[model samples]
Target: MAKAICILTGNHTAFGVVFFKSDANGCVTVKGEFTGLTPGKHGLHIHSFGDLTNGWISAGPHYNPNNEMHGAPQDEKRHAGDLGNVDVNEDGLAKLEMEIQHFHLTGIHSVIGRTLMIHQNEDDLGRAGNEESLATGNAGVGVAWGVIGICQSNISEKALEEKSNQ
Candidate 1:
């Protein structure tokens, strides 16, 4: 499997680690552990850029290569970055795990080097009856953000060399 990881950062104490593991079929499992958030739902998305020079704003918009509308992760016509929301418990901790097909960790649709962001509000999944909802799910400002990077691969160098020679 291909693997990637992100270490979140923000202005506040909210922080976390997100992991992405993908199989050869392009199915990806997203898992994350977060803390120091409000006891409620927060939007989670993948922005187009990894830039953090100017903070979250510099990350660009959602990773919508197809220019699709904002919606849930399972939506057929949604942006690739529309990952929906994560719920925080009363103790300000959230454990998230989901399987997504919109993007993978490797190949053409890979999200590596992009920005993973935690928003300040719950995503309406494009049902909020407003233009912003269609565009951004009204997911407010980003609270935490991180850049996706490749983790150590399980495939050995010999296996990779042999595969390349095939």
Candidate 2:
């Protein structure tokens, strides 16, 4: 399975981390934990570009290579990056885990080398019936963001080959 990680920061402060791995069936399992955010629900998504030097604005739109509409991860016609929302605790911490079968860490729909942003508001899953909602989910403000990158492995060469040979 392919694996990746994203370390997010907001307003120049340490924010959180997200770990991702692929299942044998090419689906993706995402596990994320965050701190130092407003206490409430926030939208999270993977953007088209990995560049975050400008607070992710340079990242462009969500990763929608398929030209789909904005919707939930399980929606039949949603951007590949639509991850719904994450709820933060009163103490400013949040944790979320989800399995998505529509996209992967590699290939044309790959989320690798993209930007993950945490918005200031919850995503309504494109049910708002507004133009902006269909484009941005009306998820106010981007408080934090990160770049998705490949995670290195610690396995030895011989062990790797032995497993492949099996």
For 93-142, candidate 2 gives per-residue lDDT tens digits of 99888999877988878888899999888988888999889988988778
Global Cα lDDT for candidate 1: 0.88
Name model 2 segments beyond 4 Å from true. Answer: 155-166
lDDT of 2: 0.83
Model-by-model lDDT, in order? 0.88, 0.83
Clashing residue pairs found in predicted model 2: none
Model 1, residue 19: distance off in Å is: 0.5
Best by TM-score: 1
Model 1 Cα lDDT, one tens digit per residue, 12-31: 78887887888777889888
Q: Alpha carbon lDDT of residue 62, candidate 1?
A: 93
